[model samples]
Target chain A: MIDIHNLDIDMGRARVVSNLTARFETGRLHAIIGPNGAGKTSLLKAVCGLLPSATGAIRLDGHDLTALSLRERARLMAYLPQERAIAWDLKAIEVVALGCADLSGEDSLKHAQQQLEVMGLSDKAETSVFSLSGGQRARVLLARLLATEAKIYCLDEPLTALDPAWQRRVLEVFKSRAAQGRTIIVSLHDIGLAAQFADDLWVLDHGRLVANGEPEAALSDEVLRQVFNITGTFAEGRNLRIDPQALPEHGA
Target chain B: MRVKSLSLAGGLLISGLVLMGALLIVGDVPLSGADYIEAITHPQSLNGEIVWGIRLPRNLCAWGVGAMLGVAGAVMQGLLRNPLAEPGILGVSSGAGLGASVAIVLGVGLVPFAVEASALLVSLMMSAVLMAFVARFPDRQALILLGVGISSLCGALMALVFNLSPSPVTTTEILGWLMGSVENRSWQDAALCVAGLAVAVGLVPRLRAGLRLLTLGEETAQSMGVNIRHVTLIGVITASVLAGLSVAVAGIIGFVGLAAPHFVRALGLRDPYGVIWPSGLAGGVMVLMADGLIRVMPASGDIRLGVLTSLIGAPLFALIAYKSAKSWA
Candidate 1:
């Protein structure tokens, strides 16, 4: 669904994302994973066309992403940044409705409302998003992305501040959406969640793409040791277990 | 909700007509309701030229200018994402005031519209330059500091112009404009203000989406498909023009711009369309009512619009700000 080629995002003098090439096919959940300072978020932003590529091309469904207008891109793909603090006192449902702000009519409103309910936010429909707990607010925003009818959902750390049960629920929602032929690319901090939910993974370190493939291959001990400077085993049992083989990623 | 809309529309129309009528009926030789009607029908039958020709046009001009100031103030607060923002804060008004002051001292009274337009244009350019400067900084404090610096610079230049003028009449006239009055405006001035107001009203709806996103701060707005630079420019230009036209007509009316929109917002006028129109209406009503008070009450020299507004608007503003602070947080 998306192709990123030789992407290098330069912020000031430093390159946030080094030359990177990747394809995100339709109908699967792909996770971008790495330690702190990784260019995972930058890669997601570049792919979603939020940032101007310092030196590369991002294509969505064979269309040059940079050439597409905002409305066109917004219609085909949805983006949820890591931070979701709203300044206005908009209702949870109204916040979701903003995803389809360009569109007006009963059908769009109904669809948005349904998406809010799917995120288990129907009871909080009229509640101000600011009044809701952090996890609930994230769910409200997720519903907004779901309401877009966009082919791809680019989420940068959708799991932050979510409780463990809510985290599982959100990951399941992404899995189900991918099963229904939507592309989900998420920047995740939780390695276990990435392995549990992602059909494919891209591991980044120091602005460079270190590994990309099946979750098992990308999260392998060798790649973990090299990219994260820590050795860990990915044990496939009881909902994707993680064996903490390293005392610490760095010297204690 | 529909009731609120209807009541709002009804209130605006009623208040506009009543205030216009009151303006017509009051003067040194007060006209009765019948006399006021006759004066409109038969212009030559007026008691004094100042009553029909001067006072009427001036009243209309004041009404229009007041509305424009209020709308500009509301939009600036929204655009800058700060409740305390006003046209005066960004030096747009001061810049425009300087341009008008230059024209006044240089004797360009014939095409008041042209003068107003030039003022608006200059102010808009200054705001654009300031916005460009502001873009270099990540912090809001930087933008405010830059604006304050520009305002002070303009204020100094304005003071110099008043000081250097050959006659006291120039200084007096500039002070009158700065104090803001609806005393003796001509029909041509009324036409100018109306034209400016029409342009602003037409522009507001097209920029509503961008304005909505802007409240989220620039980065967030950009993430939501808003082109920040274009929207900010549109808002700044539109606001500058409105405020410039207001200053050109009325001198330096204060507090209407600062207090009127916020008053309406504190009354739960959050939607852009309602905020624009009601703020305008509130501006008109507030200025006219204050003008009426200045005319009728107390044995005194001409009480300036600016003084009365800061007197009334400042307290009302403080109250509203206190109430809304927690909501914004």
Candidate 2:
């Protein structure tokens, strides 16, 4: 379990994540959803120790996160950033093996191969990442994330550039990992998919946590109207449908 | 991939050995196989004196400087995550050159190896400035721009040194040093290169894993337990030392570091770890061949090794830039 209390993240003079307190339980897939510039990515970055400006207490499994060494933190949590442009022409398997960097070379390669197979990239394992399509590269990156075998996985927009089928498959992989008692925290833009696949939802608006609970309770009508500025109909056994609407004036 | 990388490495090693052998025999005073044996056995003989006193040290210096630059280039490219990054891009070479010029013009030879000592000090100072910039910005583009800025500043300072040169002889000496050569280099120069190469070899293991992780970009590499600051510090220091030592021994040789990694990459070793040592070998071969060519050429004035390397390296650099731009497009 991860516990965040009174967290504040700042970029330059602007605060990106305000006094946010939340508990992320293990064995659950928690999805953070928000519109652009709503601190979704900032919150995720803070949790992963990527944000040095983040202040307040973050405890992972009852230990202070800030006190832990970077290697120890990495061993506990793996992060996949949204930007996926690899700088070199590393082979797919080689890129994935970086996730298991602590392992012996042969062992890391073996684990990386397994993860690549998990992502349905077995055939592309030896292919240079530059030659792969964007979607394939995304999968390759996802495989790298999975290869970490960390207790907590923080993925920012893992589904970007992926096809619908692959997106579902990726979610299923995360769901399975969550089932095995690992905590999965993902910042996603796809509200409908978050509702379908996530066990819990955290909604943010203007650097503040607006709502947190099960998707049905957290993504309330007020959240849709106030945060997203969209009216949405969400019912059990039906697809979520949202309509874009103009923001209502407070006086009117 | 392993097979291909190994084969490429083997090819480069064998080619470097052949080039070295050819270079030993094909100098201005051509020596037969018997003469080589005699030169090795009879050190008091005239041929032995020529071979031992001049040719060996010069060739060794060339090989050492080339290898150092090549490895330094590979490390710079990997650390910056830029295909075009090299020691020169970071102004380390120019800073060393400026230092040497200062030492020469000011007649600051109060101590042994004063020029070399000054060059190393300045290059290291440049690297320290770069490290501070990296810590402040942590952005690759910004780091690259800062490097360009430093390079320009060093270039201007070097020009000032030339303008204020006390005598024509002093100016000529500075000019000759800037053009870069291993000509008249002694065993000390060769030893300096060997020391730099040894340091590079020691750094390779420490550098390999981090560089491989860096290909994923800094943030992701950090997420995977890489210490970005540590890696950057080691990389900059190692590269600066190698480039600095090369300049101290052979003046301001350019493009060998930039071109060597590319040649290794072209031979199917794309990963930073696989590229480094072979890149060094390729660089040694390249300089040996260039030196041999200069010796065999019929030019009126001596064609400096630095000029020949740039002549070959600049075109390759352009081709690489074009390819990178095309890929971006």
TM-score of chain A of each: 0.93, 0.95
Q: Please list, in the order the candidates appear, how each scores on TM-score for chain B only.
A: 0.85, 0.92
**What would the TM-score be for candidate 2 when compared with the true structure?**
0.95
- Tens digits of per-residue lDDT for model 2 on B140-220? 677678878988999999999999999999988888878889877888889999999888888877977788888887888
Candidate 2, residues A1-252: lDDT per residue as tens digits?
999999999999999999999999999999999989999999998998988999999999999988999889989999999999798898999989888867876898999999999999999989999999999999999999998899999999999999999988999999999999999999989998998899999998889999999888888878877787777787774356776565554322
Can you write out model 1's per-residue Cα lDDT over B258-318, one digit (the tens) per residue? 8877767666655443576788888888888887777787742467777777788888768
In candidate 2, which residue pairs clash? none
Residue B4's lDDT within candidate 2 is 74
Q: State which candidate has the highest TM-score.
A: 2
